[model samples]
Target: MELHDRRQAPWHDDSFEGEMVAVMTVGVPGGEVLLETSRLLLRPWRVDEAVVQRELWTERDPRVPPHRRIDEDGHPTVAELEDSIRTHKVWSTGLLAVERKASRDVIGYCGLVDSGRGATGEPELAFELLRRVWRQGYATEASLAVVGWARSSGYERLWATVWDWNTASRRVLAKVGFIETDRKEVDAVHGTTLFTTRPL
Candidate 1:
């Protein structure tokens, strides 16, 4: 797929009054999420990535847990993932592509997922990354960016659901200011999931 990486401040040295007004009104307030930290870029999920299924799905890396791996071999099949992405559940909300800037390779994702409604049933946050990119502080960086996004966009809080055994994620959540608030196991999914929350 042709990756468009220039989603950021379009204004440079060249400026026209008409364009400048447009930039100030929309571009400045609507900051593009091309978040970078010298290593990775936390960008939106792109469509057209079927060939990456095996690598993203089946790999037994520490970065992702067993349940979330949609593929048996590596990554989700292009067809399956595209289907997921097309669904409003996956496409409208939830998910991102964690890319290594130097290589433009999508190692994995660190993003938020909508967990239905809160007491009033608000949105939720879920995140993950490939094992190859784990423990290098990329998760924290991307998550912080997500938090900023949630706050800037008027989200009140961000929540996370994680397996009890995933101490690594627990730590990352704490690092990003999430505290263990509640726990519930989705019988439909059949695994004990801890629900943690933090104000945006």
Candidate 2:
């Protein structure tokens, strides 16, 4: 998938214009920073983990819409994963791998992204864990950290989108203080998408 260009300012609602200007002045973080939670460590993508990241793309849950899964051809090639890592490296505050503190295993990725789906161009929180790790509260835990990081980074607000069928994700957003917004969109594969947001 094509990544959002981090060089551009995130979109925001009209009421947030002043806050958005303030965020732009502060700018993005300059380097990777480790975020620690009770049971996980969130850190930058590593080149050696390309294969692990590719498995994540290809092994999504069956409930996920086709368009959100890996391409029909198969798992992303190693080269593709490397390219993705390179793109992620460009954004100082982009996605990071979630490592379980107990096993030291990388289970998934969670972080912020600039999204146009809301037409607000603001940063959107995103996360996906391996199917094996579902229902373990990892998503909510990692998300809380990301939200806290955004607030401390000078963002005025953050946004997110969830497929209507993704009740689990919706709950996770709620746990992290995101409220459903009036904005919605329909996609050919993912069906109806609900937008949500929270102030930083």
For every model shown, what is its TM-score relative to the native structure?
A: 0.67, 0.77
What's the CA RMSD for each of the models? 8.6, 7.6
> Cα lDDT of all candidates, in order?
0.57, 0.71
Clashes of 2: 4
The number of clashing residue pairs in each candidate reads: 14, 4
User: Cα lDDT for residue 117, model 1?
Assistant: 37
Residue 137's lDDT in candidate 1 = 75
Largest lDDT belongs to which candidate? 2
lDDT of 2 by residue, 1-59 (tens): 12223223432222221221111212334545456676877777777777777778777
Q: What lDDT does candidate 2 reach at residue 158?
A: 86
- Show pairs that collide, candidate 2: 10-121, 11-120, 11-121, 11-122
* lDDT assessment of candidate 1: 0.57
lDDT of 1 at 99: 75
